[model samples]
Target: MRNLFFLCAFLLLAVACKSPEARRPVQRSSGSFIKESAERNKKLYKKEEAIINKIIAQNSDKDFESNPNGFWYFYNVKDTLSTVMPKYGDVVTFTYDVKNLEGTTIVSEKEIGLQQYQVDQSNQELISGIREGLKVMKEGETVTFLFPSYKAFGYYGIEEKLGANVPIQSTITLRSIESSEEN
Candidate 1:
């Protein structure tokens, strides 16, 4: 009986010593979904850009400048003298309004009254275009910006007035910039 037990243990150890095999996935991904999504985004961006460019071309009177961040702007009140633009932690007070490409007001300045934001420091609810636009502005300067859908609202738009993936024009007036360096 002891010999039989020894034999069974040896057989079990021998069977357990077999090298493990790597697991194979039941189904492999072809990466087509990712590629297709990327292609779709590229096309959407191009379409929006074309529409913005056409608007810019039609309004040649304004000296619209293209930002590398994928937007366009023309300063309604450019402060040539003041070299001070808001820096990190500086508090800036501004008022802004949004309109469609057709120049229909979607959000009035009165609707979004005096906005006080800390430059690059606050978790304030501002869009990407407005955030970037604020960094380029000096106190007492007003600029009109043309933002693509992604920069403005992207997939989620303003509740009822604005729809998803729609470009918009916003005019911002920088009232004051309280320097953080003072404190």
Candidate 2:
């Protein structure tokens, strides 16, 4: 009986020490959550687009052009002669003001003050809409951009001032563009 017990103990230990097997999850995730989240975002963007379209319709006088980046803009002051636009490594100085769709000012030009940003480089934190808009602007040009919530603030918005996922309007004045080649 003692020998049998010893043998049983050794067998148990050997079995326990055998290479561990990966335990399969009882219920595998079907990725429904991700799909649902994506669907929700699609609906939200569609609704926001409709609202932006309505605003554009109301302001027929202003030429609001749709951007491929899912924002809209119209030139407040277009620079026709200057074909120069900021490219990668170029530093651009500009001032911008943020407003809601209802034309309420969230941030004034004075509050934002002067901004110096390096094009296509992560030197400064800027909204995606503004970043894309700047690439298309000529020096001394002032463009009013209408950005969707995703382009403006997305999930995280300006603290205390702008709520999450809020669409906004920003008018950027491209004061100067220092060419990288010049540097």
Candidate 3:
């Protein structure tokens, strides 16, 4: 009688510990979450593009005129530095001072040092504006090009610390310090 009582007690305890459902938390379907995020990103991209277009329209009347060969112009120089710009495979070194048209120093190379960038057809290393700017510069020329937010950061601002709605109408200036020597 005692043994039977002990076995029954053990079985009762085991049954009590068993869970009616699995031990893991129920997983949500990722497809729905991904779709929602993609829609949100598309909306944000459109908003950013609209702001950039507005800035481009405003700056269109500035000194530089857009040319088939160059990105954007600051002044109407027939022999713009871009006339001798580098090709995509060329490597170049440069110093730059990026500022708004209002002369707010957004970035300065004197404070940071010289920067080197390679011309990449694959859009791997440089922004489209910078690439366009470099295409029209000589080895020892200093040129300034303005980049609307669309050309600058677009819908996604600087990936690091710059938050959203940071105004895409800001300007940037770049100077070509040297052209790399070909081996």
lDDT of 3 by residue, 1-183 (tens): 999999999999999998798677577675988899789767765665465455557866655545463235453233443545666556677666555544466556576466567776344445566666666666655555656544555466555534443432223233443444652
- CA deviation > 4 Å runs, candidate 1: 11-25
lDDT, each prediction = 0.95, 0.93, 0.56
Q: Summing lDDT over every window of 10 consecutive residues in candidate 3, give the lowest-scoring window.
A: 165-174
C-alpha TM-score for every candidate: 0.86, 0.89, 0.49
Best by lDDT: 1
Error (Å) of candidate 2 at residue 54 is: 1.0
Worst 10 residues of 2 by lDDT: 118-127
| Candidate 3 residue spans exceeding 4 A from truth | 1-30, 63-78, 99-103, 121-133, 136-161, 164-183
Error of 3 at 33 (Å): 3.9
Record all residue pairs in model 1 with backbone atoms less than 3 Å apart, i.e. clashing: none
lDDT of 2 by residue, 131-161 (tens): 9999989999999999999999988989999
Better of 1 and 2 by lDDT: 1
> Which structure is stronger by TM-score: 2 or 3?
2
| Global CA lDDT computed for model 1 | 0.95
Cα deviation of 65, candidate 3, in Å: 6.6
